[model samples]
Target: MATAAVAGALGLLWDWLWSERFWLPHNVSWADLERPGVGNFPRARHVLSAFPLAAGIFSVRLLFERFIAKPCAIHLGIQESVPHQAQPNAILEKVYTSITKCPDGKRLEGLSKQLDWDVRKIQGWFRHRRNQDKPPTLTKFCESMWRFTFYLCIFCYGIRFLWSSPWFWDTRQCWHNYPYQDFLIMFVHHLATIGLITFSYINNMVRVGTLVMCLHDSSDFLLEAAKLANYAKYQRLCDTLFVVFSVIFVITRLGIYPFWVLNTTLFESWEIIGPYSSWWLFNGLLLVLQVLHIVWSYLIAQIACKALVRGKVSKDDRSDVESSSEEEDVPTGNKKCPYDGSSSNGANQVNGHMRNNCWAEE
Candidate 1:
């Protein structure tokens, strides 16, 4: 904790000493805060001198790099290995071989089952590959470009907000003839706008992706649950609720917010009233949408958890059946050959405890 505190203090000190040199005009000075548009630095000396604020900001970046990014990379690596690792199982191998030998509708169902992934996900991958073969889809490229622009805008706007304040500016005193309080407010407002847009975009993307994955999983659950008299109605209700709430959250996060931001009449009102007057209204709506999203996410997670638990229980039961029936099994030829029907002997090879299955005929 002490070390973290030290690191944070150092970070803030570093920001104080160098931030102005890099971000502010050379002509600006500490005295500029006394000007009309500038802010008062004298009043912020105590808070800016504290250790907590600096530590908090530095810790966030540290947490992202150390906890989030590393874990996400590991998860992605594991996911990438799934298809290769599962390739040797006879059922999986057959599905793989069929997919590689066919195209479009001919392979869709087999590939979908083999991959244990949604058809939409497989279609997306195929679309991405096809787009790679060409110049790339204009719409996708434009969206990516806009996303990059938005990220850049948010980053710079945040920096501006931090530096514009008297509390922050007093440390380095950058900016000439600018009042500290007013410019600080403007900077904060801009930061808020950028943050809102970035968050909205991310939420929209996650909501859409989640909804698609949920629909696929729900379909599978419905089919499986139909075989169990007690589970069918409950599963159907869960699926319906998930779809409905997910749609609502997506519409609010993506459609409403973007529409509000883009509307000329709204923009004019916001401009006339100023950010201070409109901040509460805008942020309030976002807060409500965020709450709805949280609720939707919770529902989805609950359904998934229940499904996973049931699947594990079913798998255990199947394993018991296989074990109990082992002594009564009929004699058969090589376990791999007739089941896989693979021309290549390589399909029978095992890596560790897993069988190899390829999505293509080798």
Candidate 2:
């Protein structure tokens, strides 16, 4: 009974949140927007389709990874070597999960004294523990391949659809519509994207929403492709593609996105339609996305600086380091680690930190 009551209250809240008075302009009504003679506008019910679509995408991803991605990884000679596992320790496990993955020196000293183990042993144990959780190199390759394929296809589709769109050329047309974990950043980005998309769709702002998606899809595939190259130990190719991806990322995300997309939404829309409650909320989300862009761009700049100094894109900055000894134990040519730094000899070595290669937007 309590559950039902809570659900009922939540349902009412949702309905209240989507009230036409809140979402639509005072001069416009939901009924007027939904008129068949006016325009084909999105309804609240239409957003329900995302559920099945999400399920279908998941299923497709599994099949694609299993069949296509796995085979490609094998063909490219990406192999999985067993990583040394950390011994079970309840205290350490709790600390790793609830606290920091990498313990500070002071915490390490405390843990060492409490566990009656040397600091070096504890550090080694943490390294092995980190490796245990890090996905296998083959797994990473397959994941990147799947993402590359999906993003590339979507980008092409977006372009095809937007080619004839008026808003593609003139961003002002969108005002008429009125709309990573280790992947943590990517995770937040996905959530933000979903929020923006859902909010825009509910407000019948599909034109601007589509533009946002296209702009994002434009640069994502390149990053995935670079990861694939890095995984395959194609050092030169990986470095080159990383450079290209960085350039495109900066141009689309930092340059075009703010100047073109945000300008239209922030300045042009306000000028044309003025502000409303929903309008402020929508723009606020866009600004959130822009802030993320700036954060990522700073990270990419650091990576580029390191690459320039070293003359190659060696490792992913976001990756956690595993034990260096692990790579020493594995035979060369078969030792591939996810997010592992490439060795000077052009072999992708395990036991290095994983880089931040996966960035998703919708």
Candidate 3:
């Protein structure tokens, strides 16, 4: 009974949110916009079609990863490394999963006494356990390849679709109505992107939305390709692609998006259509996106500077593999730490185990 009542309330709320008065201008009505026969005009209902399309694309991605990307990984000689495993311990397992992967000195001291183990052994066990959780390099390669394929295809399609359109040349044509047009797939995980696309579709502001998607798609594939190259140990190729991606990312996201796209959406669109409540809401989302672009651009710049200084492509901090401070190898027989065999200095042993190099490049 409560579930039914909640559902009913939600249904009414959805209806109220999409009411004509809230979305459309005072001059336009749903009756005037509705078509009796087949027409090219975009409708609010058309956005529902994206749900099934998104699901289909996801299914296709799984197939592509297994069949295509897996074979490519084999051909490229990208194999998963077998890291040392941690011994089974209920107390340590509980702490690793629930409490913390890396226990502090106080926590470690308590755990050492509880387990009747040395502090170094506990540290090595945690290190090995963390490495176990990391997905193989082959898995990383396949994921990057899939994203690269998708982004490349979408960017090409965007170009083909926009080539002959009037709005391709004229930024002002995006505001044809007070109005609407007709689309992106890279928005699957990004909440902001999903919100923006849904808003654009409902408002018929698709022309500008498509442009925004294409602008982003332009550099995304390059980043993915660079990762694929890095995973395959093609250092020169990876560095080159990274440079190209950085340049294009800055050009498209920072230079073109704001100066051209935002100019039209904010100043030109307002001048053309006049301001409504939806207009402010739409531009606000676009601004939020712009803020993200700026933040990413700064990170890219830092990476590029570091790469230049190193004279090679540095490890991508943003990649799936997270860095850990602990790298001491788990002992098989003796309880002594890895460094005990080589040297008596504990500090040198710890520092030696600290691998600054990332897994992907190696």
Candidate 4:
């Protein structure tokens, strides 16, 4: 369905560009091909114009797979790895280990240190167990952005086609010129825009799903980390934030309310009000919704950044401990332990003190 919409939109755009009188060789007639003119390469030009449309479709598909499908898989993989019936201590160990070994290894390290865990054990977990996959790379993210932008451009073209429709024009008391060439132009442009918007909307839905999954998976990790650290406060805070943002993300993306509102308004307008007035009101509401959507997106970004930073800090502290321990083990033969007198006892005391102090800080 999305493909068909996009194809239709692209076709409309192609016709519009060709038929509309503009800077680029205006008044080119598609019907003129049968007349055998001196400069007749209509078929060739038409075929050539399609290349960009085809490329645009392909690019959008590639991006959808990257940002949406792949991220969801990563989140699910992490969620599946959590042990359900494990001991609290065992769960902690597993959580810590998984954090270190997972693709978001830095975050795990920060989390371990924040929770006061043995970094070596975390490293061991990473070495012995495989993590789910990594999230999509920045390149993929950029690609997705580009694809969405392309869709937006196409959607604008669709707006132009829809705006010029006879139904709209007549109602608006605007000029109603439906010449064959112009009609063909409008039709092709509308087709392209519809196709692009359809593709974009589906991809956006997938992205929303992926984000929800990530929030879910992150919550589980935080819960286990909180348990290990006995920092119930932080855990609760994170959980609340995640849940709230996740809900917001899902609601805005699904656009359930806007759809209903639009439907209601359109129905009322069709029955009693005129088409022009109905369309104007609908467009106004759409603009408002678009603004709200942008604001929601910004909020989501802020929350995600906060979570990532918190996780990274915790992991970094864990790595610091492992480094300190390795330093202590370096043989300083006959040297007194830094914390006590007798060399052997001193070394043991120093190591113990280091571990205790680290855990106490947590």
Q: Which ten-residue region of model 3 has the weakest summed lDDT?
A: 353-362
- Candidate with more favorable, higher lDDT: 2 or 4: 2
Q: What TM-score do all the candidates reach, one by one? A: 0.21, 0.77, 0.81, 0.25
Candidate 1 TM-score to native = 0.21
Look at candidate 4 and tell me the lDDT of residue 121. 52
lDDT of 3 by residue, 255-343 (tens): 99999999998998878877777888888877877786787677676666555676567543322232233333324453433223222
- Candidate 1, residues 1-362: lDDT per residue as tens digits? 99999999999997775343332224544445446654334322332333564466456645654465445434433111111112133643454355532246646777777768666455444433332333212222222233223334443544454444442323212212322323223322222223333222212211221122222222222222222211122344433433443444345434543353223223532443233322344345545544554554454444334444553211111111211223234342323221131221110111111111010000
lDDT to native, each model: 0.33, 0.69, 0.68, 0.36
Query: lDDT-based ranking, best first?
Result: 2, 3, 4, 1
lDDT of 2 at 64: 98
Expressed as tens digits, the lDDT of each residue in 1-362 for candidate 2 is 99999999999998897786779766777778667677555556755656676777889999999999999999999876677878999999999888646588899999999999988688777778887876777888888888789889877877887788787899887676453001111221233345566666667666766677778777777778878888888877887777777678779878998999899989988887787778888888888888877877776666665666787776543333456666556654586643443422121221111122222343
The runs of at least 3 residues in candidate 3 whose Cα sits more than 4 Å from the true structure, single-residue gaps closed, are: 1-15, 178-193, 316-362
Tens digits of per-residue lDDT for model 4 on 31-86?
54346544322232343445687677678668765677446434534222221122
